[model samples]
Target chain A: MKTNVKVLDCTIRDGGLVNNWDFDVDFVRDLYDSLNAAGVDYMEIGYKNSPKLVDTEGVGPWRFCEDDFIREVIPEKKNTKLSAIVDIGRVEVDDILPCEESSIDLIRVACYLKDIDKAIDLVEAFNKLGYETSINIMAVSNSLGLGLNEALKKVNESPVDMAYIVDSYGSLYNKDIQYLIETFKKYAPNKKLGIHTHNNLQMAFSNTIFSYEQGVEFLDTSIFGMGRGAGNCPTELILGYLNSTKYDVRPILRVIENRLLPLREKLEWGYNTAYAITGLFNEHPRSAIAIRKSNAKNNFLGFYDKLSSVETHEDIK
Target chain B: MKTNVKVLDCTIRDGGLVNNWDFDVDFVRDLYDSLNAAGVDYMEIGYKNSPKLVDTEGVGPWRFCEDDFIREVIPEKKNTKLSAIVDIGRVEVDDILPCEESSIDLIRVACYLKDIDKAIDLVEAFNKLGYETSINIMAVSNSLGLGLNEALKKVNESPVDMAYIVDSYGSLYNKDIQYLIETFKKYAPNKKLGIHTHNNLQMAFSNTIFSYEQGVEFLDTSIFGMGRGAGNCPTELILGYLNSTKYDVRPILRVIENRLLPLREKLEWGYNTAYAITGLFNEHPRSAIAIRKSNAKNNFLGFYDKLSSVETHEDIK
Candidate 1:
């Protein structure tokens, strides 16, 4: 029903955080073909982080989405475009090629509030290279009383094609989302809005739809909600909800059944109480992820107590 | 922050539909104690259906919810009250004891849109015997163009203390929730409202919270979302979100870790592609449930195709 809405499948990029970019080439090829057949607008192949800047010894090819690697995985570009994410200081502009010479069609810059200037600089560079660009502000839930207005104004003044509201901590509720969208619109009125969500409390899908209703044009989703900690909004859910003739959900469902479901045997993601606790406090999920790897994985009460004690200590300080 | 909102735990009642009421007495006792310690306002022990009306050979004691059975399980009543749900034709007035003579504090009648009259009769009977009463209209999404206005008006004129919006098929979105709340307010202005959701699309927690924001007084939840099919909103989520000193989430988290986690080995519930497909079509989950039981459990594409064929055939008709 919505013609302007664009769905970006970030299964390989966002889901990389879960498996350390260990996706097989066959799986990647299947996903690429399925997403194209499903009529998804864009597929974020992976990150474009420079290998020289970060440790990529054990990671897969997705950690550094070289243009040659992308072409090898997906030799032909279909209706779905290609995208890659880059964090500030993790990317080298020299490694990126002009849009006509590369498989990547869009380059998104992910950053925190403190790195807005650098993010805008990279987004401006990517835009100049003839690729669509977006600036994703991570952890906007913790941006309370921070200089979000100023950051949005800075982004608004840039050449960014889209500005994303990323719920990195997965702590936002409907009211917070409403407030953030209003703030974004007020300061960044010149830019299009996008929504990226995490499923720490099973609100990823709902909040994404709520954002769409409030005029967010771009939505970020992944296969089976495979991401760090609690995962992201599921691509199948968004495709099924869209129910447009342009999009076919059957292909998406097939890929999930064939590829993503088997990976669940070794990898763990989705909603858990430990992750929910961290999200409740608007904290990073690194602690929860660590505890899950430890023997106290199921000790949610202990996790809650630890968080409560930290809050108390902070208050005392 | 929300002092007037009441939380109801329906793990045994709604969850009974999944496992056929086969909960152990020890498990039930543990859940009861945990919910009470967690400061839940009410706990729906199970159904009060008459054995003469429905076949109950293999079912557990929860299907009956006899006063003696509840008393045996919970000898002492704490701050949390007890409630039971019954259907229109499956209950007999003589089977119910007076509030002062029984452990039950509330009696809720569940019905479809066409059975509003029968539901109100039961509510009136229960109210006359000094028990809190409510009327839950099931599958209201399918009640489109039905006489919902007439049904709500009839319930508004009854002795029912609460009116519920039950998304029986898990088919509602935010716009539908907003519209339903406004319609319920317009028709049943005097009755306090409650929400009971299904998580087929992973919207139960968000929808419940949205309803609360719109001033719905009573909230229905289950431990780890252990209901039929995709289950209800998780009780732990609401407790964490409420964050009032009156409610403690540690006990709920413990119950989930100890009791509900083990139940996952035998029972398959939660958001799956098959369930999401049925929810998107606004159809009952019987087909999805059946497919989940068959060899085609993971064949989401086949399931989607089957549903599509049926829809096409119906359109021809």
Candidate 2:
């Protein structure tokens, strides 16, 4: 039986946040081949944001994926369709060629709630260009209540094919994912729901699966969960859960072993107490990241004082 | 309203598998004080097994926890009560002091289902001594069908206060956990269920939460998830999730940062590709542990091929 869900490998896009998209060309190409052989539905190669727009000087080609560079990376796109994330103000409209003319099959718009209008505009443009478009509502945990409802309503009416529940802060719990999905369903019934999770609380894989059980079709993942602070749901893990005959666990495992595992020693991401604390506070991981980079990485009391106060919190719901 | 759950820390006992209970006296004592301040319900101090019976050589004081060692560790008993695990064949009856006379309040019997009769014998002795007793069914994932039901039937009639769903292999999923609990409940409805999970698949914290939501009470955790192989569900993450005013996450965080974080550099544990592969195959982690010890720690594909055959598996349920 055909499954209702699709796994999107976001290794280059999300992992870029850690290393300024400095991955070697050979590594990225091998990743493309691996994910394709592994039967992943979508491979988000990198960002479409123009380097000039973001003023990325020392950043690599993956940061601002030119059409030419993308073609060189994946000379012949196989089973895994290539995609790119475009920040609202960071990409020039002319840079995004029509889907038929470009190698990218999908163009995802990532934006804050305040920047929804720009995201919608970009989504419309990408849609008119005959590309599958998704609008990722970044940092959904911080913007709850009416602000989120209205944003969902806008995406529901927009031509975007998919709307994602992006937990950028990595603070959401299983119950939080359920509540958010219910809220999203109420306002965005017309949109195919997607999920992007982080491993701050070590809930990424489970939270993503919860979304799948809740009927969210598009799930974002990374090989070995190699992404920004705390990382994303691992491709190998979710692939095991999806367990489709078409998806081979070996290729995903191969890529994780040969390419990403050693990167972890230098990069030092995933479930750490610092990230766990930021996830608990529902704050940006900047402070935690700062602590990780400092010599006082083990000074949990200092970091705790920065986030939590002397007043004991009695609320547990 | 008060929550019907207890947090049981197995830092000394579970983590002992990694460092052979070679923790400094000051570190163990500090962990005890920290857990008490954190409002943890119980802290499993160490093993109650006799050194003479086990013929332990290099094993530290934790392996043969004497009543005197307990008194010295917690001179002033606080909020958190102390407990110890006793292996069925490794402890002599005469070595156990009466619970009221000793510093330990609980004596948990860790044994295979085959040893249920012997486990009951230990439980009965500990019970008559006025101590709470628990029968930990270690490696529940491996013995699923009839073997488990028969074991549960035995424990239900025993005087044990709690029966744990122990995933000793660091394998098992949310669905597996749910199914096993259902199977466990059917045969042992009278016993309060507890959960002990490992992080081989990075599902420890989430799986434990699933158990809590499904009515399991006691949770086994260690600071920084420091334990055998891939480790256990982190205490701080669960403490954050429980979110009770009574529980201070900071104290747990402080102990983890000050004591355990540095230990991690010397001893590697937590989810990795090799462990993830072992978790997938439902095999023992000895092979993965060997790979981790060897120079090819990052050789995930090599390990995957070792456990799994080239024949494509259509057998994921």
Candidate 3:
């Protein structure tokens, strides 16, 4: 069902976390044009994180998506609107300008369960500045039970235009996505909903589709799944699957052919053994990353032997 | 959850279909040793289809999968059992004789809904010849209503060791997979269940896992998703996700680093727009493939515009 649901391409922003945001201006401009041609609803160019707050030297544009740099990249606006994310702690309030004055149409605020209040503060500031605002609760997998209920209450009361169900750990299944969407809908009936998923579990595409079916208005995607640790669902996948003559797959293909593919050659991301295993265990991927870096003689049989021999214990949290 | 389920690596058999079975002897040997080390229950070396029947003058080894060639490749049997597939009409009974004397341990029969009788006939012959046998009914997506029930009856009467829930069109979702597993269990409770899925819909891994949760014992995978259309679920994904330390991912990774990645540059198989769309539409990906080849002038805004205008439809089946 290709309704009013919008797909926001976040390859540079979220994906930058994987490669330290090493994208060039020409690549970003081409991605913007391509995504616009591909019927993408919005292009999340990068995070508006303060470079001074985080180490930014040699980092990618996504790590520091400055307003002036973004405006310079896309000299003229097209069909797709531009968006940028700001973490509760990483961005300064003064950095956000009115939508009429800046190229960004949407400003998203991301936070953990305990920081929704701080996130709401940013959302309010952005909203007052006349920009579309969303509050994305990261690491929702760890915030099940009562924490979720309280968060939902805050979301309901917030001035945000949209609320996001962020599967930051990439640990959620389809049922979990369904539960989260239904829960959010029940609690915040008046606010629109969005989805931001990671492919650590290979469920990002399905989870996003499930959310769409449940009436989510926005979907977050990347070109070639270029987000952190296993990546985000590929934007081209959504465009192709939706089969809407409105969205062009060529833009995404161009982005892959030009930007993401080269990035892939330089930076190893996407589905790897360690990430897949961590997904299978429903645990954080730190263990898998450690194993990969250790270069422990590639002995799969040995690994399997160790896993099976371990006492069947509680599932990894 | 990682109990008695068995993994069968069919990279040569299934991926051959995508690449015209052009794999070399060395790659096959490496895969065999790696799978053995990883404790994969079975490795499908290739198909047993007759060269004469399929017109294989320049066809690849993976396409033909001759018993003699396979015997020469692996040389010795180890922890992993060797298996070969035979399509109903494409294979001659005489072509299988050497398998009985070779390292082959299983012979699988693949057929469409209309060819169950032919598949059963082959299964019976393979069983009598002292080889593990299975009947894989292809295009189960089109097997609606009585078609499924009728096929189940034939499978119940067959001598096959396992009956497969083949999502040939890559159309089945998780719930659909669960239903098919339940249906097979109801009709052929005495037989084990297997899964053969394509990634056209990106559900191959999730659907395979759903089958496992439903107590289906056999799982099929290919390396780097190197089968037809979007290809099969990546073998490494299955191995890593199964949470079986016994299924070491290194061997699979080694296979990719040494063989599949290079092959990927020459061949154009793997997850793509056409396959993903086909999966989303629950239709064959032939049209999407045609679109990709035609290089039609892309109209991105038009595509999205159409989708946005349409009333939402719930036809993700």
Model 3 residue A211 CA deviation (Å) reads 2.5
What's the TM for model 1?
0.97
- Chain B, candidate 1: TM? 0.97
Model 3 lDDT per residue over A1-317, tens place: 55788999998897777767777788888888888878899999888888878777788777766778777888899989999998778887886677899999999998888887898888888889999999998878877877888778888898899999998768788778878888888887778999998887567887887788778989999988888777888887777656677887766765575566667778767766556655655555555555655666233334434444656533333
Candidate 2 docking classification: medium
Alpha-carbon TM-score of each model against the true structure:
0.97, 0.95, 0.79
lDDT of 1: 0.90
> Tens-digit lDDT track for model 1 on B1-317?
67789999999999999899999999999999999999999999999999989898899989889998899999999999999999888998987899999999999999988889999999999998999999998998876554998888888999999999999889898778888889899899999999999999999999999999899989999999989888899999999898899999999988888999888778988777888988987778888889999999989988888888783322200
Off by over 4 Å in 2: A309-317, B309-317
CA lDDT of every candidate: 0.90, 0.87, 0.78
Candidate 3 residues B270-316, lDDT tens each? 66545565565566555555554565423323333433455653332
For each prediction, how big is the interface RMSD?
0.8, 1.3, 5.8
* lDDT by residue for model 2 (A1-317), tens: 13778989999999988888889988999999999899899999899988768877878888888998788777887888999999878899976788998899999999988889899999989899999999998888877999899989999999999999999889998899999999989999999999999999999998998889889999999988888889999999988877779788888877776788768767977777888888888877777888999998879878888778735433222
Sort by DockQ, top down from the best: 1, 2, 3
Docking class of 1: high
